[model samples]
Target: MQFEDVKNARDYIVYSQGMHSYSKAITKMMDLYLSYVPYVERAHQEGKKAIFCSALYPTTWEAPLLYALDTIPYATGEIGRLSDFRVMQIAEDYYQFPIETCSMVKCLVGQWHIRKDDPGAVKRILGVSSGCEPFNMAWETMKMQGFDVHNPDVIYRAKGVDGERLENLIKFFIRQLYRTIEWVSGSREFDEEKLRLEIQRKNRLLEKMRKVLELRLKRPYYIRSLPTILILNSGVANYFARPEEFEATLDLLIEELENIPVDEEENKKVIPLLWVGTTAQEFGIYEAIDQAGGALLGFRSSPNKLFREDVPPLEAIAYYLYDNQRAGAEIYMRRFLDEELGRINARGMILYGIIGCSYNSVEREMHRNYFHQKGIPSINLEGAFQLGGPTGQVLTRVKAFTEMLS
Candidate 1:
């Protein structure tokens, strides 16, 4: 259930039959969990500070900032709320945060309450960039409750592929990124050298992810191992704190993958299914797919855009800015699905529509329609966060879809 070292973790992965990529993906997560116990104990004993923010924001860069400021970064979005839905309900039931608000946003409210009286609780919250209405509202509510909330002011719209508009978008994003760092540093000046080193490490992690993605593109069996899910879970576990541990797992994974020769005949028999919509699996989407016998090519989400390592920090931030400029409408996602599904040779898709997410829910019919036209079948599964859809129904649909594709 828990491994203190990576070797034992690898053995656990080998033993877990239906876990697919999850067992390995979760190893670094466990390492991070073990680190958290020490992190909390240290913060309490040594009087260290922590900053809370959304994981949606690129907080990996803050590792250097944390070291410079003598603080730790807590992505409440990933750790605080996603760990338990009851934490989110606390905001709605007790705090009277609007019941209609996004569950993730409401969870932030509950996170604040949980930490409000803690000896090492953080007072400053780095607000979100993407203005999901409920998220902004939650930020505003936290400000009212005396937390220093900093929201990056920027327009959220897709700047077309390659142009001056995209460049400008990147410039604007870099400016906001610098401002965020400056604000986080406050009286304590930022250590440029430290940040550069931290970013280099972050870029290295991204490069490893890029390699994993590259391998998955050519080898469908890699999907069964859930490399993408492993990447996502690494973030969920706040692997940024101990990136090398995460990298070590990557090393083991890469070594293991290299040894297992790609079976051409076996690959031909497996159905390639592209997962669309928000990345789930705090509730077991990856395991479900494994049980259903479908090979997931990858997810169609912001995670797909791997960060660039070669460029200068500012330019890289610009590239990141442009890459992350998600359109509010479903058109961009539709285009991505059309392009990627074909590229990956995906036979079918599973679109997980979050229950209260207005944007994703409205696009379900259009998603089904477009895939139908392309002769690619897709099932839309609905749920709140990763709690997921009805298990029997979801697995049945997944099995049926795989059977049809096969």
Candidate 2:
């Protein structure tokens, strides 16, 4: 059921407020779905089993098999997009968490509370143990609400801090991800060689699809929803672990989207920024930014359409596996960054990092320094979906930056 009217409220909160507000914002948004006190019946209802995890971590990791047995295990926004306000209010009203907690947490707790009533409201809640506090806080909060929030121990088992270690970490996560999920789902683990072949296959499809993004960025005037290229990258990468299926989807999506002449450009002002927050769907910040003359160029993170062409059960060989093999979250963002910085002509960037996400925070620093040194007008404005901007403090920074560019 498509709830067109049910615009992802949690997303709006995060977008509007920032990552600090997600805990409360997400809960508040989910509040609208109930036929009870808060949420009146709406038409557009998305019934997929959703799980929220760190984009960087999720791409390079996987939830255990138990989550896959019931969940459509996946990560949420790149940043500041998924906030549960009502739930945060609930948590705040009761617990009085300090100002340091990321809004994503309160929102997750609030949502879990609701899910307890509707098992299908959300079956699985996977939290990443990225930073010190959030890892412990998230599980404790969920346990308080009685929800099975799975935390994957994706420790980078390699030595050194060089890119090789990073690469090793990526391989490590991908290798064990599915086996973990399989174990969770009461199924036998996949052979390592088979999973390795799957990663190679998906990587090839990623290579092809990235070409389309290159074309679109090089010529945005012809592409409609150019951001879809990034979104599709996430979708296709995650859905099909095999090469043939990944290619089929990439070929079709690219052929259809890339075919549209590159003669058009999105008209929103604000110099059109792709809100790169880790959990970005909380407060319609992108929409508000667009309202303030900026196009929220959507996510280059884990999208759902990048791999819809070869519908899973249709293309892969009889023995193909697609459950918790997280293949897409690997290299999409790096590619998207290279592509969008060229096309979106972003004025400045926002970090939208949760208070304690080590991987995302590190990625944000890398993104900021890269763009800042390039002199492309960027800022690593930190805020959760629930916290900042109560007084337009962030907008003040953004306003200054916008003026400097103008």
Instruction: Compare the candidates by lDDT and give the number of the best one.
Output: 1
Residue 126 Cα positional deviation in candidate 2, in Å, after optimal superposition: 3.9
| Candidate 2, 1-406: lDDT as tens digits | 1223325643333233332132232222222211111110111124434444443322332322222244333443332223446666655666566545666666655555555676345444555444357547757766676666666555523223446655555455544554445544546543444434444444454456556555544443232231232234333323312224335545654565455554444432235565565434323333334434444443444232222224321122111222222322423355566555555566656556655455567777777777677776666665555533323666566556545544
Q: List TM-score per model, in order.
A: 0.78, 0.56
* CA-RMSD of model 1: 5.3
Please write out the lDDT profile of model 1 over residues 204-255, one tens digit for every residue. Answer: 6556655665566556655453435545443422454455666687666666
Residue 211 shift from truth in candidate 1, angstroms: 1.8
lDDT of 1 at 36: 55
